[model samples]
Target: MSEPQHDVDPVRLGAYFALIEVSGLLRHAIEQQLQADGDLTFVRFQILRRLQLSPAGSRRMTDLADAIVFSRSGLTYQAGLLEKAGLVVRNRTPDDERGVTIAITDAGRALVDAVLPGHEAVVERLLFDRLSQDDARTLTDLLTPVRDHMRAAPPRSATPRRTRP
Candidate 1:
């Protein structure tokens, strides 16, 4: 039996590979900076950063998982680690006992503040410095729709999980 072929032109194929390569390289650099400056993994930094940016410095676990495109189980584990480090606190929502909200601590905010300068510098050096103003605008324009389209699918937290028999 032979595998079926789908049509993908060379230009699109090259663009896809280039995007993936660039994304991987950027993530590696960011991860190193996060680890060095804040003793954080990329996902943990993302979670902390998101909570830090929220007006109330907190967010529901499911919402956080969906926003960061992380699995709920993985986010829960990371949250537990953050909780242990005194960087964040988890509390059950008053309105919904089943729902948990994760809030950044003062320590968490301080850590984010400490790490941000290096993180910004690394991002500036690796990405922004390489792109012209117009190129940056165009890149954002091109990618925004793709991001929105992908996000239109149900978030992972909202998807039903399978049960074992």
Candidate 2:
């Protein structure tokens, strides 16, 4: 028996492939620039940016992992490196002993400040330069729903912690 014809035709597949290719290339360029300019990895840069923008310059480890789609253990390792570098602090949350929070340090903030210009330049040169303002807005509008939908799903590291009564 022949396979049934369905949606996801050549056009859709090509579009998906193009999107993936662009994403990978853009990430590579950004990562290279980030490393060359400041010796920072993309993941570490993201963590610092998130913590810097967060209220109180901190977020729970799990939340940070979820936001970055990183494994909890992976985030823990990165946080450890940052801690050793004096770029961030990791401490148990007072309200929940099982929970750990990662906070950006002054050094992390300074590093981010130093890195932003290069980061912005890389992003703009790779992404924004390829599209008009309206095209960028359209891409955001189209992708936001897909991003929200994926984010709403159960994350891989969302293990529940038991609380003492």
How far does residue 76 in candidate 1 sit from its true spot (Å)?
A: 0.6
**Full-model lDDT, candidate 2:** 0.91
Model 2 agreement with the true structure over 46-135: per-residue lDDT tens digits? 999999999899999988888888889999999999999999999999998789999999999999999889999989998999899999
Candidate 1 per-residue lDDT, tens place, 15-60, comes to 9999999999999999999999889999999999999999999999
In candidate 2, position 119 carries an lDDT of 90
- The 10-residue segment of model 2 with minimum total lDDT is 154-163
Candidate 1 Cα outliers beyond 4 Å, as residue runs: 1-6, 158-165
The C-alpha lDDT values of all candidates are 0.92, 0.91
- The C-alpha RMSD of each candidate to the native structure, in angstroms, is 4.0, 2.3
